[model samples]
Target: MADKQNVVSVSDRIPALKEQRKKRANRRLIFYLSIFFILIGIVVYFQSPLSHVQQIQVEGNYTGETREIIDQSALVSGESIWSQSLGSAKERVEQIPYIEEATIERSPDNITHYCPRTDRTAYLHNNDQFIPVYGNGKLMEEQSLDTYPSDAPIIFNWQNEELLEAFFVELDKLGSGMINHISEIHPSDDDPTLLRLFMNDGIEVETTIENFASYMAPYPTVARQISEPSDGILHMKMSPYFEAFNPEEYAGRFMKSTLIRVMVG
Candidate 1:
């Protein structure tokens, strides 16, 4: 009786072991098949248009400059968004000296966003030809425009790069009110460091580069005090004072030339 019970127990254990092995085999097979299907799906997803960049957007741009910046970034439509080296592309965009900064972002919908912060442009006037000078003091010599910008000040004889760069920095400090009123800027013949600024309202300003912005800040106030359209040169080197332009020389030039007073600076 004992031998018969033992044989029955052995038979039951062998069938249970075989069932567990079968279940393990089925799980492994399912896992491999799932991995294969996932790989296939990944390949299809990459090959389809969904993975490619369909649109590109540029923000905070003026003129055709942003377009050129985007082109330099090497970001284009139909390119794989996943494959693009965004950090490198951004570095390339910022390579332009005039561009202060560049931001690049990729959207989940396969869109590329690029924003390049370019410096405001000022004109270096040369008679009929006007060259663009960026706020960073980069003078674009190759490019020239015939028309003069009424809103911007025209810089004259700014040959020295260092001084011109410093002058541009001073220009950055001026507000639109003062900047728009300024028609021309030139270095003094006797003292090159001393600047002569011609205002559109007909007032001439004489000051050094050190006091440019601060001296020009009170222009509107000082201009209102004078009765004539143009009176004399406003000397702001040490302090604000007026030197009357000999009215007899330039007619319709200075409004208060009636008094030929010799005021020594």
Candidate 2:
């Protein structure tokens, strides 16, 4: 009986080994099911519309048509967000005149955003047609129009683009009130650096490009002091002064010329 008790039971050992194997099989099956579910989630996410750009939005100032900005970017709706080329789109959008800078971004909500900063500072007068000029001095000649645009002053017969751009930068200091009064501006025949401005209130002005805004700042006050603004010219090149036309002397001189011609004949 003591020897029989010390002997291990083969049937009992078999049941314990089988129980350990079953636990291992169950663990393996659960791990495989978790991995399969994860893969399915990834596949569903990529195929969903939320991962694509369904619309485009723009914020901030853009003077041109919204369609033109979209066309220039070459970004199409319904394209995959992962495939959207943000860098190239920004470069193309910045190529449009008056757009100083452009930036693009996308979101998981199926939207693409584009923003551009632009300024229409002036206009170039070309006969009956006109071209839009930006604050950075970029010209939009392609969008020229037959009708006159009164929003900005007309720059006529300007030959140098570099100088014109610099002049525009100087004009900003005067503020909108002074700038709007400027009807037309032309470079002097003798010196392009000298600018001749035609005021909307019927006064001619002469000033240099270096300090144009500062010199013209006193115009409204000076104009108010003058009794007759239409019959004189304001010189702001160095010292501010008004030179009035002597119509009586001019008429007398004309009479003398006609008298001489009549007597000689």
TM-score of 2: 0.74
Q: What lDDT is obtained when candidate 2 is compared to the true structure?
A: 0.73
| Model 1: residues with Cα > 4 Å off, grouped in runs | 1-34, 109-113, 116-121, 247-265
TM-scores for every candidate against the unseen true structure: 0.76, 0.74
- What lDDT would each prediction earn against the true structure? 0.73, 0.73
Tens digit per residue, CA lDDT, model 2, 43-156: 887798767777887666545478778888888887777787889888998888767787687777444445555556678888778898776667789888788888888888
What TM-score should be assigned to candidate 1?
A: 0.76
**Which candidate number maximizes TM-score?**
1
For model 1, residues 101-122, the per-residue Cα lDDT tens digits are 7778888545454554545546
RMSD of 2: 9.0
